[model samples]
Target chain A: MKTTQHKIPTARPSGQRPSGAVVKPVGARPVIGGASSDRVIEFRGVTKLYDGGDIGLDHATFGVEQGEFVFLVGHTGSGKSTIMRLLIKEVQASSGVVNVAGHDLAEIKRKKVPYYRRNIGVVWQDFKLLPNRTVYNNVAYALLVTGHSRKQIREKVPDILRLTGLSTKLHNYPDQLSGGEQQRVSIARAFVNHPPLLLCDEPTGNLDPETSIGIMQLLYRINKTGTTVVVATHDHAMVDKMRRRVIELSAGRIIRDEAAGLYSRDESTREFAVRMRGARLGQPEDS
Target chain B: MRFTFFFREALRSLKRNAMPSFAAMVTVLVTILVLGVFIPIVQATTGAADEIRGKLLIDVYLRTDAKPADVARVRTLLADKTPNVKSVQFVSKEAAYAREKARFPDQYELLGKTNPLPDTFRVTPINPDKISEIRNSLLPVAGGGTVAVDPAIEEVKNRRDQTAKILEATNFIKITMALLASLLALASVLLIANTIRLSLFARRREIEVMKLVGATDSFIRWPFIIEAIIVGGLGALMAISLLAVGKVAILDPFAETFALIAAPETLNFGLLIAILLAAAIGVSAAGSTLSLRRFLRV
Candidate 1:
């Protein structure tokens, strides 16, 4: 799916906190990543310990440069979600530094968290669309929140919906749409603002093989537009087929990171796994 | 954020979470209904009390053999010189006898036409609060003082103890009612807060999605606030409707039952509705704001 380009809202100046944020004088401290426009996300030895003595993440260190489509692959309880949470600043790092879009998240005031989140888009495994809102409203919600003009919302929403292959289902509620279509709505909502970064936590986790591939293709196309897309999923087959930059997590720690990574050594085994999954999805084995 | 968008979202959420919205509305209805009815009843009771107090008067009876000139002078003195006296009316012995006869016809018949009633002046006080002071000023000086004693005046009956007791009772009622109304208002605020908290709890996921979508805390909160206000407003409307119905069906029909007391018109329907609506919206907004503060941290 393709559509005419639309304007994305520009990011706020780094280190300039929004109202209600703990106000610090501008340039109170040197900007964290001065002169580094290409690096979008940087984490240096970030550690996160939950309230009950459980380690959510342990001294994780990584950087995702601009316009890169990276996959974070891990098993359940491997801290994949924690990384996403940290990137979105849902939880703060217990120790060390975490920076997104050149603003140090630790330094970002609590009130400014929403402003920080607007710079990126996020998707979830559950396809968190408002049950009552139509596909159109769901997509427009992204623009509506960032306080876009009604004219901008009217113009931007349809283009993004078309891009996500949901233009035909504009008036359809989430329940009326198929799982794949609902996920498309989620994608449309996530990318409606054309955010600099897109974070998907198991975007295809709830989908069947054919539908999952369609979603991946859509995400791949979105990534081609120079928007950095980071997807955290355990879908080995899709990861293998894509052969993209993959960061692997094990027990709250990154174990393996590759420029172009596969989940396992054997591509045929992954293909068989995908076929079995398709079979369970009621797709013919041959397909 | 667009106002229309917030309004739409609030409406959608209210529909989506029908049970909580209904519960909140019901809470508002009960709370506002209590305040609405309680206020007017208090006003009506105070009016009735004041009417009863207004009728209280002091009677100065003359001696049986008193000269007419002395009676006339005393009446003039009460009317013109008494500090808090509102008005004075002289009732001759014949008029007094006629009034007594009208009041107790059988007793007058047993008296065999003898006019035993005394001539008196009824003194009405301008300020009920200064009744004691007026009574003290009117008492005849008995010994060793230059204060002139009108010997022809037999008794000064001001009903001081009775008036004090009545005023005390009315004040007690007023204070008790005010205290009760304040307690109910406090309870209403707490109930509203609890209901809004529950509604917000059910919509916590929606709030999470909103936050993820880059909504500022205010953007995420405004819909819930507006929804709460609407629920409160509906509750107020319902309460006002109920009050209007009650006024027509209960209060107006029974007006004769309270004919002895002046009707207090303080609870005008239009003014009461305006006040109730403002209170409903204000309280709901306050409750929602308090509850949303904890949840909108995302």
Candidate 2:
């Protein structure tokens, strides 16, 4: 049900170094794909070995290009949220590198974390709406943080609310709205700044089936605006319905990565496992 | 940055974290209360001590047959020997007896016409601290075991026991008062820091939301700063009112009970108000910043 998005905020985790990562040469970044500079999210052998010897992620490497809509479908604890956490700098990679929007996440200083995070919008299973604030103020809060003028915030908040289908509920508090409507306010808040990347962790996990489809459609429409959207979900039916690029994870490793694939692939194709490393040039070679 | 937004959010935050806010406010109330009371007491104590020091005197009784020239020479001698003696006055035998008779009329009546009291020299020191040195210089010193005496002097009394007791008591009062004020102020700071931590803990959810929304550290800090001010200011204002009520009700009614030996100069009412207002804003700002820097991380 509701999973990974709830996990990302147990942040600043104690991560021991994963035992078996190849140390790269100094001044040389491991370019997973030869032309990987344009990728909005890049992970090169990233691992997160949490405290108490539990591995959250292990030696995962992949890249998501600009304007791409991707889904990270995994059961709970399959490291779906770990990848998102790495991108958002919520947790440091125990080994290897995670680069988002052309900046190595670990290199961002502690004080500057707020500035770095503002450029990326993040929503989770919990609507995480300020219950006391009205929907308009909640959405306007995102724009306010980035130093938008009151008038500029006035212009932008309503537009984002309309896009999220929350224009009529602007003055309604979170408790006054339905589950899906509350989620929409959070999404509007996340996207109000038009961040370069939008991350959603089980955005529709708590909603009913029909409401979920509507929320998915809102995210689909937002992705059309050239903002890269990454959704981490355990909802097999929704993943199968969308049929977008899916990164499948099981037990902290990327087991299969498929372009426009269903939630699960046949076990018989195990030997033809899709390679995640050098994509965007062509299709699968099974190597 | 909107005022209405600030007020609205501040009210909600105060409600959400009521315990911590109350604890912080109570701590502020008590701190300002200590400040309001401590300064005046300390000032009053120091003033009383100064008054007591000014009244201390040394008495040197002279040989009754000693000439006025001998008394004058003795005065010059004391002035030269001890830089501490501020002034010296001679009381003639008749005058000494008259003053004594005024104090103990029954004893003087029994003695009839025979005046047994000696002519005396009363010496005042520049300060209480110099009483012993000036007294010693007025009499003869012993080089050997033999106690040599000044020829013009009959007996010398410096009121050494009385002087020692008063100096010790006043000094003790001043030192204890200073120590207590300092310790209370220090305790207040520590209490403020601790209560702020509790307040920040209750604020964790808001902080997490702000951080996720990509608020600048200052932006995230703004709402908390506002809450602390509102709460801390309320506490301080209540303390001021309590003090005003206390001045009229307790201190005024029982003025004699708490009266010092001498109620010396004290903290003016206007100064106390100014200090309390400044402390309210300043301490709340500091308390929030101190706790927020550590506990505000998402």
Candidate 3:
């Protein structure tokens, strides 16, 4: 196997970790019709009405600027997945505009939607790796879709694999790997394109808290490279500890948009605070 | 490079989804096999029926006083105007009398100088099923005995008792073969189409992964199309090979031993195989591409 000379991304200290800086009010109306929208993702009065008149998202609006790490924290059926689906163009907005990476989702033709999606990478809780493909091929598949040269894939795949800490398991198929390793491969595939935006739908939902942190750290490192990351997860403790922007949804509505948000204000208990304190002490969070 | 990648991916999936792939292959094989074996049989049987049909001769007797102009008009109507009449042979009363005299001199001599055989027009139709059509056109529209509506034709005579049985039998054979061949083909196509659909459902997650990873729709679709082609092609080839062996080893011997009345032209084996291959592959590819629409709705 060929080795990548590209340096592997290292772990970040707690203090230096990236977080969302700008705080916006809940349900803020997105400014429309700018020549160059710095917002990597913008949802303006977005609503997703599914078949039989069921609403997936109800006039929800939010924006994430370039290079922001935001967590989408919501319960099951709270319409968090709908936002990710809209951003990725998996589902269309029923009555609003969705702009991702400055391309309006509604404007993309069906034939050109694939090219439009190339700018955004998506991950799901299931890790969604090709079951029969090796980790290397799974990651390389992203670049392959864009018609990259063999040399480019050979170089880029290993670098992303190394960054995701899967260099040793390049040839391992998804089912052969642990849940965390599979999730890492999934992330590697999603990040290999170095897309401007990455959307994760409960990416670490199946992994233990420890493995979930490892996956999150890998995402963090990618986010540090200036890729805007949107993680839709219900991992409240992990979101609380990271202190990134949390966009919480309830009943198809934006209930909270907090800068340096906890998973929930109610989750900011004394026990959780002690855990954070211990996490800050010599017992490292990176491990 | 893209082609090679798609082919490799197809091959890998073929191995991974061995059961569904096998079922698809088997379905194609059975469809082609049924078609291959039955088509030539139908063709051969129909050819024989056509041969028997070619011999149906309709004899139309003309009035003894028919004018030359009337005879010419009747010939023109039967020869140029009719749809099914292949050829019209004119035999005058003297010519008909001479033919009968050559066969039996005493009976004709008993007739003495009087010749009872009228000037006849012998009509050969294109097909046996067409005999009734040709006969119908010659009959009087007023509907009586089998006399022509034309003034020249005294009576239109066919050996209805003997010819009716042959025409009915041949017609039944042709109709049954045609119906059976079409039904088999339709059944085969539906079977493979369903098989491809089921396989797609099984591998839907694979499609989901490919789409989310920024793969274009065409990029995601190529491997599946290639896979279907392989399955369809392999199945058709297998069935064809079996048919070829059966033709050489079994059918050839039986065809020779029977000493059939006429050597009939059946469907060309090469053309049949080509058609089967094309149909199998086309259906497989079409099925996969169409079924893919539901899952690709991103």
TM-score of chain B of each: 0.69, 0.66, 0.81
Clashes within 3 Å, all models in order:
0, 0, 0
Candidate 1 residue pairs in backbone clash: none
Candidate 2, chain B, TM-score (2 decimals): 0.66
Native contacts present in candidate 2, fraction: 0.68
Each prediction's RMSD over C-alphas, in Å, is 9.5, 9.3, 7.9
Stretch of 10 with least lDDT, candidate 3 chain B: B258-267
Best by DockQ: 3
Tens digit of per-residue lDDT, candidate 3, span A1-287: 11111111211101221333433332333334441357777776788999998879987767788888889888998899999888877788898777777777899887887788788888889888888888998888889899899899999999989888898999888889999999989888888888888999999899987677677777777777889999998878888777777778887887766665333323333334345544555444442
- lDDT (tens digit, per residue) of candidate 1 on A19-96: 211112223223553425677877666678989988887766666778777889989988899999999988888986
Candidate 2 vs candidate 3: the TM-score winner is 3
Ranking by lDDT: 3, 1, 2
DockQ of each: 0.53, 0.45, 0.55
Q: Where does candidate 1 stray beyond 4 Å?
A: A1-35, A261-287, B11-27, B50-160, B260-262
If the candidates were sorted by their TM-score against the true structure, best first, what order would they fall in?
A: 3, 2, 1
Indicate whether candidate 1 or candidate 3 has the larger TM-score. 3
CAPRI category for model 3: medium
